[model samples]
Target: MQGPAVFIDLTLEDQAQELRKYFKSLGAEISQEKSTKGIEDDLHKIIGVCDVCFKDGDPNEIDAILNSIVSIMVSIPLDRGENIILAFCEKLTKAPDIPLARVCLQSLWRLFNNLEPSSPLRYHVYYHLVQVAKQSGQVGDVFYGVDQLKSQFAQCPPSSEQMQKLYRVLHDVLKDTNSELSSKVMIELLGTYTDANASVAREDAMKCIVTALADPNTFLLDPLLSLKPVRFLEGELIHDLLSVFVSEKLPAYMKFYKEHKEFVNSQIGLNHEQNMKKMRLLTFMQLAESNPEMTFEQLQAELQISENEVEPFIIEVLKTKLVRARLDQANRKVHISSTMHRTFGIPQWQQLRDLLGEWKTNLNTVQDGMVKVAQAQVELTRKQKAAY
Candidate 1:
C-alpha cells in the first residue's frame, strides 16, 4: 500500500534512495540464516518491490543493484537461489531490455551451471537464456548464446520453433557488420550448411550468407574468408553471387566479377555458353546506352562479335526485357529506346560524367549567344539615339 505512494509522491532520486534502503534491509535478512527461513514466506513481496525498482531505476543504478542481487542470490543456499532465479526470469521475460537482459542472462548462466544436467527446470532456464542472447551483437556473447541454443536443438523431440530460433540467432550474429563474427559461430554455420540432416538448416545457412553478401555495406570476403571451410567455398560462393547478377550490380563485388565470370564459363555448368551470352548482352546494353543509334556493323565491332550474330543476340536480349531495342534489318541499324535499372560501374560513371560535361558546355554556349544578342540590341538603340 505504501509502495504506490512512495513511487507517485516522491521524485525518482528519492524513490531510488528509499528502495535501496529497503533492499539493503531485505538482503541483510537473507544472510541471517535464522531469519532467512521466514524470509521465504515474504519472497513474493520482496520480489515485487525489486521488480518495480528495477523497472524504474536509472541504467547505471540498475546495473549496480542487479550485481548486488546476483551476489546475494549466489551467497544464499541453492534452494533459495532457485526461487530468486525463477522470479527474476519471469520478470525479465515480460519486458526485456537488451542490456539489462544481458546481465540477467549472465546471472542465469551461473545459476544454470550449478543445476543437474538432467534437471527439467534447466530447459525453461535455457530457453530464456537463448532468447536474451539472440539479441547480443558481440562475439564473446555468442559462446553462451550458441551453447544454450545447441543444447535445446539436440532435445529428444526437436522443435520447429527451436530451429527457427537458431536461424534467427545466426542471422543476427552474421548480419552484425560492425562486430567481428566469432569463428565458432562461423564454423557451426558452415558445418550445418554442408552436413545438416534437415534441409532447412542448410538452406537457412546459405540464405544467411546470400543475405550478408547482398548488404552493400558488408565487405563479405575479408571477414568471411578467414574461416577455412568458407575459404574452400570461395569460388562456389562467388559464382552463386554472380548467378544472381549481384557481381555485376554492386561495384564492391565487381573486383572479383571478371575472374568469377571466367570461371563460370570455363568450368561451371553446361549452360555456360548460354550464361556467357546473357552476360555479353548485359555488357552490350551498357555500350548501347552511350551509342543509342548504331549500325549493325558498329554494334558488332563494339561487341567484338560478327555482324550475323548481332541481330540474333539482339532478339535474345529483347526477350529478356532488360533493354528496349528495335532492329532495323532494312537499314542495317539498331535503335535503343531505354534500359532497365542496372548496376552502375566505373564505365557507367564515366558515361554519366561525359554527358554532364557536355550539357555544361552547351549551357555556356547558350549563355554566350544570349549575351551577344543583348549587346547587339543595346548598340542598335544607341545608334538610333545618335541618328535622332
Candidate 2:
C-alpha cells in the first residue's frame, strides 16, 4: 500500500524543487506557470528534466517523479500522449544508469499498459522497449519485450526491414538462452517476411534453412517445412535437400549430394561430411523404429558406412539416446528395444493410435477378470451367510 496523497505530494514537491535548482544551474527554468500551461509542454519539460536528473539523482526519487509524470501524461489527448511517450523512450534508450533505466522502463510499461491496444503509440513504445531491453542483457526482459514487439507487429504490421531487425535481435538473444525457441522464432519471422515481401522471402527462407541445418544441435527439420515460404520452394533443389534431411536415409542424402554437389557446396554452405553423419544417425533411428532387428550388413548398406565404421556409428547414435539397442556383435545383429521417431507424422500418429487401442484392450480384459473374481467372492459370502 502507498502512503497518503499528502506524503506523495510532498515527495514530488521535494523532487520538483531539486529538479528546479538543477535546471537553473544549467540556465533553464521550471516555473510554476510552465506546469500550468498544458500537459504537452509540461511533459516535454519533465522529460528533459528527468533525462538529466536520472543521471545524478537518487533512483527512488527519480522513479517517483517518473511515475507521477506518466500518470498525468496518461490522462492527456492521444496524440500528445504518444508524442510524450516517444520522446521519453528516445531518451530512455541512451540512459547510462541501468538501475534508473529499469525504473524508467517500468514507468513506460505502466503507461503503455494503460493505453488502448489500438493506439499507434503502442508499437513505438514496444519497439523502443525492445531496444532498451536488449541493451540491458536480461533474458526475461528481452524475451518479454521482443514478444510484445512481435505481437504489436501483428496488429500494426511492421515493414520488411523492421521485421528483419526484430528477427535478428530475437535470434541473437534466444540462440544462447533457448535454441529451440530460436528456431521457432526464426520460422515465425520467415512467415512474417513471406507475407510482407515475396521476392525477399525466398532469400530469407534459404537463410533460415541454412542456419537450422548448420546448427549441430538442431535435428528437427519438420518444423521448417511448415512455413509457406519454405513450402513455396517445393520444386527447388533446396527444398528437395531439406526433404532428404527430414525423412530420407543416408543413402538418399548421399544421392542428393552427389547430384547437386555444386548447389550444396555453394548455396547451402554446410559441411557435407558432417551433414552425412547427422543423416546417418537419423536414419539409424528410423531403422531401429521400423525393424526389431537389423543386421550389420543392413546397417552398412543403409548408412553407407563400412563394417569397421558400423560399431562406432552405432555408439554415436546410442549416445544421442534416440535409440536403445543391444549390439550382438557375435551374431552381427542389433536387437532394438525402443527408439525415438525422428519425425512424428501420420505413421507415428497411427502407431500411437494402435498402441492406445492395445492398451485399451488389455485394460478391458483386466477389468473383466476383476469383475468375475468379485462375483465369485460375493457368491461365497452369500453361501456362508445362509449356512450361518
Candidate 3:
C-alpha cells in the first residue's frame, strides 16, 4: 500500500505512468487476498496504459485517474486501503488547480462516509479535510468540515487537549463571521471539560464570555450566564463582570472597571473604549425598551456620554439592528418603535402571554361583530320574502 512518489519536475505522462504502475502493483497485492480482481481490472481499464497521457493530454485525464483511484479505494477493505487512499487524497489537495483539489477532497469525504461512526480514523480524515478546506478559503467548505468534526466530537468525546484545539480552530473560523454560532460551539466545548477539569473549564468559559462581550453583534448574554464553567466563576470578578453586561448599564460597567482597574486591564485584556461602546449600545437597548421617546439629554444622562456623542452612539446601536428607532434631531428625541430583549425569562413569558391574550380578545370581538352582521342579513332576507 505504498503511495507513488510523484516528482515535481516529472511531465504529466511520466506522472500518469508512475501512478498507473503503483495502482497496478497495489491492486495485484489486494487481488491475491480478496476477490477484487474485477475492481483491479476496472482500475487498469480506467487508467489504461497512460495512452490518455500524451504530451498534450487533457487535464481532465488526471481527474479521471484520481476518480478511478477513489473507486478502487471504495471497493477494497478499509484496513488495507485507508492509508494509501488518504495519502493520495492529501497530496492532491495541494494541486495548483483548486477544482481538482476540491474533487479529491470530496473523494475523501466519500471514503469517510464508508467508515464506521466510531472509527478513530474519522477524526484524522476530518481534521485533514478541515485544514484543506481552510486553505481553499471557501467558507462553506470550512463550515461543512467543522460541522462534521463537531458531530464526531459529540458522538465520541475527545480528550480535553483535543477539545481545546478544536475550540481554537472553531473560534478562528467563526469569531468574526458568526459570533452566535461560535458562542454556542464554545459553550458545548466547555461542557465537555466541566467534570474533568474545573479550572480549565472556568478559564475557557471566561474566554467565551469576553469574546461574546467584545462582539457587537452578540447581544444575548443570558445564554452564556447559564454555562457550567460560568457558574465556577460565581464569586470571581469575571463572573460579576459578566453580570454587568447581562443586566446592568453603562454606569455599572464603568463603576466596575473603576473599582477593578488592574483586574479589568490585566485579566480581561479588552479595550476600555470598545467596552464602553458596547455598554452604551446595551444601555440604549434598555432605554428603548422602557421609553418610546427619549430626549438627547435623557440618553446622555443614562449612557454617561456627552450630548455630541449621543447621535453617533445611537447610530452604532442602530447598525446592530437590536433596536428600531427614528432620530428627531430638531426635537432632540429618539423615538423607539421596537427593541430586542437582552434575555427572555419568566417576565418576558408573561408579557408574551398578555400580548397573546389581548390578540385573542380582539379576535373574539371581531367574531361577534361578524356573527351579528350575518344574523341581520338573514332577518332582512326573510322579511323581504314574507312581504312579497
Per-candidate local distance difference test: 0.53, 0.72, 0.68
Off by over 4 Å in 2: 1-37, 45-80, 95-123, 144-169, 189-200, 215-217, 254-277, 294-321, 326-334
Cα displacement (angstroms), candidate 1, residue 267, comes to: 29
What C-alpha root-mean-square deviation, in Å, does candidate 2 show against the real structure?
Answer: 5.6
Model 1 C-alpha lDDT per residue in residues 56-132, reported as the tens digit of each score: 55656665555444444433344544565677667654534666666555555664554455554555555565555
lDDT of 3 at 253: 96
Which regions of candidate 3 are displaced past 4 Å? Answer: 1-72, 79-110, 113-123, 144-168, 176-180, 191-200, 261-266
2 or 3: which has the higher TM-score? 3
lDDT of 2 by residue, 225-275 (tens): 888788778899888888888888888888899888888888677789888
RMSD in Å for model 1: 16.2
User: After TM-score superposition, what is the CA distance of residue 170 in candidate 2 from its true location, in Å?
Assistant: 2.6
Best candidate (score: TM-score): 3
Question: Where is the poorest 10-residue window by lDDT in model 1?
Answer: 1-10
